[model samples]
Target: MSGEPEVHEEFEARLKTYEGRPAAETGVGRDPVNEPMIRHWCEAMGDTNPAYTGPDAIAPPTMLQAWTMAGLTGRPERAAAYDELLRLLDESGHHAVVATDCEQEYLRPLRPGDAITFDSVIESVSERKTTKLGTGYFVTTRTDVRAGGELAGTHRFRILKYAPARRPRPAPARRPGQPGERRPRPVVNRDNAGFWEGVTRHELLIQRCTDCHTLRFPWLPGCNSCGSAQWDTVAASGEGTVCSYVVMHYPPFPAFDPPYAVGLIELAEGVRIVSNVVGVPYDKVRIGMPVRLEFRRYDEELVLPVFRRYDEELVLPVFEGVPE
Candidate 1:
């Protein structure tokens, strides 16, 4: 038998030994189901369903795993076998891990004051396989959650512990006067074509429903409030404040610089728009800081509206924000 193939088979056999073993057992939720967590979850998700509020409020069904979270210190009941299995994969060069997907099934609703317990098992470990993210095996865990010893839900989570694939950098565009590399073009269809056109003319136009006199951003085909298809344009006052922002630093792309700030700006018109916040460092972008509109031309074919801090001196037009 070939030595390398024999080694591979032995490794696979070792991994299979962990399948169906307990990943976590006798895991008790740190907090009982309550309104404060429910309220926080609803607000973060922008969910306003009345069923989640008032005295009769039940926790969101998807919060099944939330109750079982180990937090920074992790759960005491977590088995060492699961950690050992992951260590083996990391030793085999599958050191990077990203959650691929999850599935949940709810059997009963959980209400305030319900104490939760869960047991998780290592459901399966796939044979070594190659993916766009590089070669790795899929690890799936299933957690059975219970309330007062009654089955409440099952959550299945899958992750890819992979070695990232190397990608060749795209060559710079050869055209004279063109930017080094082209940014991805915005998807402009009939619904949002006017928005792109307005950008080309150096205007940030918000859509207003002619029927109900409601203003909306991103050029929705119909009014969300009144369901009116008839709409007109209103020029943005070019003033806004950062409502929320994120600094991206992973899975680097060729057309972008890392550690950039992408802000959800609350416009003076009462609508919110997401664009890059420039002038200040990414880490310095704070909610409630004022920003002003600016148009940046990537190439002859691409022009986008971005926001700069209202306090910074205007710098020459450059690609400094998230792609629209």
Candidate 2:
């Protein structure tokens, strides 16, 4: 594939129309606090608080004016970023790009009489990769919602763009008569016990801080998000991109081999985690590779998500400016 990005006119047209625009100014938008929208939000969140449904319903902190907006389809411009990424991947032939992680922050609650505007930007893009099947790209979009000109919320959306494999690369081969590297067993704690158990089931788990309502990782006894002692374990989608990573040249553990890549992956569940990356050669690994969660079974009750190099077969001209 060429290094030059093949800009789709249809995608650009949609982006130009939606960028820096207000929904109200465009018409055909719903009021966030309107009865129907509010009820829908309440039901969607399974929140039964009278404050939201009562005559004097105080809007929930999680509510945003953008929540009232309906999903789009007819408007080719709607989801312009996602469509653009998909088109890029399809053109390249890596089709396995998938949603892995998202992080949202509620700046303020949606209230009656608030007119909201939404603006989105293509925050970042990653280098093209050669996966087993084809080439792929990882794209991130940041969408901001403003109520009455004040920041109401922010959504960080990520997608994988894949295309058919043009130059199929061989998968990593295990050394003959050599066992795979081993990772030390981690002792379960009260806070992380559930998380470890979930991993065995090939599921990701995060602790929700009751006090601050923030999601905490690494399974702390107290809420790392809010310092609250009360917490709950929530299941997470075991998909994410490599937020940061490193290839260790030195062997500190007997079970680990030299030149293995360790990465901190940002999951779609809004949590970041550290794990080993496999399935691709060490030299090809880079930040933001579009990886699917693969569970490695250890013994009877242990499983963990190990990232494999994605899109290892499609060929693309070398790209610059992506995270290493």
Badly placed stretches (over 4 Å) of model 2 are 1-182, 299-302, 311-324
Per-residue accuracy of model 2 over 1-324 as CA lDDT, tens digit each = 323454444443443443333222222234445667777778988988887875666567556424534565343224544455556456444455676557788887767666766666666655555555445555666767777777778877666665543322223663322344345668988767788778777777788887788887878888655567998777776667889888764323444444567888888777888988776665567888866677876534446768765564647623322221
For lDDT, the strongest prediction is 1
**Candidate 1 residue runs with Cα over 4 Å from true position:** 1-3, 167-324
Compute the lDDT for candidate 2: 0.62
RMSD of each: 24.2, 24.9
The CA lDDT of each predicted structure is 0.85, 0.62
Q: Which candidate number has the best TM-score? A: 1
Worst 10 residues of 1 by lDDT: 167-176
